[model samples]
Target: MLTILAAIAPNFLLILLGWLLRARHVLDGPFWLQTEKLTYFVLFPALLVTNLAEARLDGLPVAAILGAHGLGITLVLGLLVLPLRFLSPRLRADGPAFTSVLQGAVRPNTYVGFAIAAAIWGPHGVTVTALASSLVIPLVNLYCVTALIRWGSGGGKRGLGATVLAIAKNPLILACVIGAALNVSGIGLPPIVGPLLKILAQASLALGLLCVGAGLEFSALRGAHGPVAAVLGLKLAVMPLAVGALAWSFGLTGTTLAVTVTYAALPVAANAYILARQLGGDHALTAAIITASTMAAAVSLPVVTLLIGYLP
Candidate 1:
């Protein structure tokens, strides 16, 4: 237990450090925002490409893992969607707030997932995570975009074709596809390029965690307790338990099971608030869900690790 906690402690500590930095105003808002953009557009993609390009992919159960993970997320989405039909008229009438609930229920923070996977399972874990991200990212984006468009106030203004195109051009997805291609082709990276990518990849972990910290906003939770609590329960508790069961049933074990569960247990993505704001959803509620889920994960994740340790 101590060993598992020891592994995850530093990653969360980095997040805490980021929160401290932001709280102290050591770095201004624009700096953190730009840092997030750089990390997302450049550093993270470099990490994915370098890791995936070098990964030994011969024997991994790529299909089964993707299938099981996708199924798990789909089930969660279905469960969350069902409740919307039964919500109070007042709650149901609030399109933005409902959209916030939906986003919180489904989005997983891959930045934190990467940091945790690398810390717990090393390179092989990262390889599996990258692969999982390739499949999961597009799937979640499709669903979230659909929900935003269907239920958000200005969602109708955004064309489906444009949303699809934007997702297609997402840097992270592009990185995964290109890296997987390189892995399969066996062309690998040039010697000079590999070292440069390595440096960017290393920079991503700390910076990414810090950005995640800086993005946290707890003040929004006050007025939105009910919905926020529900989202947090679904995101941090229900989703991981459900996904872990599915992974086990699919015969995943060791690092594969561990990484998948960790990924599932991640908080709502920071980008959820952005999407909510863009589409006229309840951005405040979305931000609160992100903050609450992230804080909850510090405890939930270690408990999850301990549970995985006891699994056969």
Candidate 2:
């Protein structure tokens, strides 16, 4: 247990440190904003492209990983999010609120997942993490966008073509596609491009966590007891367990298994709130879910990490 704590502490502490720095105004708002933009567009995509390009994919259980992740998410949606879509209008005063809750439950913070996986399993963990991201990013976006269109006030006005366009334009997904192309084609990263991407990738983990911390909206949590709790339960608890069990059933073990669970255990994506606003879901509720899930994951992830060793 202590070993697990030792491994995971720095990542969460970086988040706390980010919160502290932001709270203290150590760096002004504009600097953090630009840092976030840099990490999202340039640094993190470099990490994805670099890792996916060089990863030892031939030996990996690609099919099992895909199955476990896809099935696990579909399971959750079938049991929870989808049902809520049918009922959110009558059951809840704010019908669009379900979209935020749904996003909170399924979408994961890949930045945090990457940092934690790297801390725990080094290069292999990061590779598995990227592999999971490649799958999870598109899957979650499709589900969330569909849910938002059905439930969010303004989302129904947007065409399916626009959603398709947005997902195609997503930087991380594009990086994954490009990297996989290079890997499959056996072309690989060019000598110069590989080294440059490595440098940029190296900068993403720390800055990404800091941006996560700085973006947290603690004030949003107040008076949002029910939705926040629902999201935390599904995201921090149900999603990881379901994904882990499915992955295990598919014969994943050791670092690969651990990283897959880590992917699910991650908090809701920081971008969900932005999506909520754009789609006219309850953006305030989305913020609450993000803050609540992030704080809860700090404890839940360590426990999950410690328990990973005991899995059958």
Candidate 3:
């Protein structure tokens, strides 16, 4: 237990520091906003690219791990669409709200997942996490955008082509693609290039966590309704359990299993609100879901760590 706490504590501490800094006005809102932008567009991508490019891929259960995530995500999507989406009277009455719920249920904060993986499993774990991100980032974004456009009161104006284009430009997906390509090609990282991305990757987690802490919206969850509660269940609870089960069936265990479950268990991506606002989904609820899931994760992550340890 002490070891577990020690592994996880620094990541949460950085988040707390970010919140405190934001609350105290040590840095203005715009500064953090730009910081997030830099992390998203720059540092985070560098980290993903570096890990994927350099990771030892020879012995990994790449296909099984991918299948587990793909199936897990599809299972969650089915649950969201058939029962809650089509059958629930409350969600039917509020399309934008439903989209927010769907987005919250599917997206994950990679920053948190990456931080935890590095803390618990080191570089090898980060490599596996990045490998999972290769698929999850694009798949989740595509699903979220599709849902928003279909159901959002203000979305779908640009049509499906535009949606494809948007996902194409996503830095995370691009980074994954580039890194995977380099790894497969066997060219490997060049001298200067390797060092540059390593430096950027080192800065990614701390800055990203700070941004996450700064963005917490405690008040948004105050009157949080059915959607928020449902999302909490889906993102934090159901997703991990489902993923862990399916992953074991698919032969993932130990580090791979834990990292995949962590990915599934992470809070909604911090940037989900941006997509919600732009696409006319319920951005407020999205914010609320992000904050609530993040708070929920502090407990849920530890539980997951302990539980996975008990696994053979």
User: Which candidate leads in TM-score?
Assistant: 3
What's the TM-score of each model vs. the native?
A: 0.95, 0.95, 0.97
Top-lDDT structure, candidate number: 3
In model 1, what is the error at residue 46, expressed in angstroms? 1.2
lDDT of 3: 0.88
**Candidate 1 per-residue lDDT over residues 37-150, each given as its tens digit:** 999899999988888788777888777678777998899878765477367464577877888887888788888888888877888888888888878877887888788888
C-alpha RMSD values across all candidates:
1.5, 1.5, 1.1
Q: Give the Cα-based TM-score of candidate 1 against the true structure.
A: 0.95
Candidates 1 and 3: which is better by lDDT?
3
Higher-ranked by TM-score: 2 or 3: 3
| lDDT at 63, model 2 | 89
Candidate 3 residue runs with Cα over 4 Å from true position: none
Candidate order, lDDT descending: 3, 2, 1
* lDDT for 32 (candidate 2): 92
The lDDT for every candidate, in the order shown, is: 0.84, 0.87, 0.88
Instruction: Report the C-alpha lDDT of model 3 over 12-97, residue by residue, as the tens digit.
Output: 88988999999999997999999999999999999989988888989999998888888899898896544787777878888898
Going through the candidates in the order shown, the clash numbers are 0, 0, 0
Please report how far candidate 1 places residue 210 from its true position, in Å: 0.5
TM-score of the candidate numbered 3? 0.97
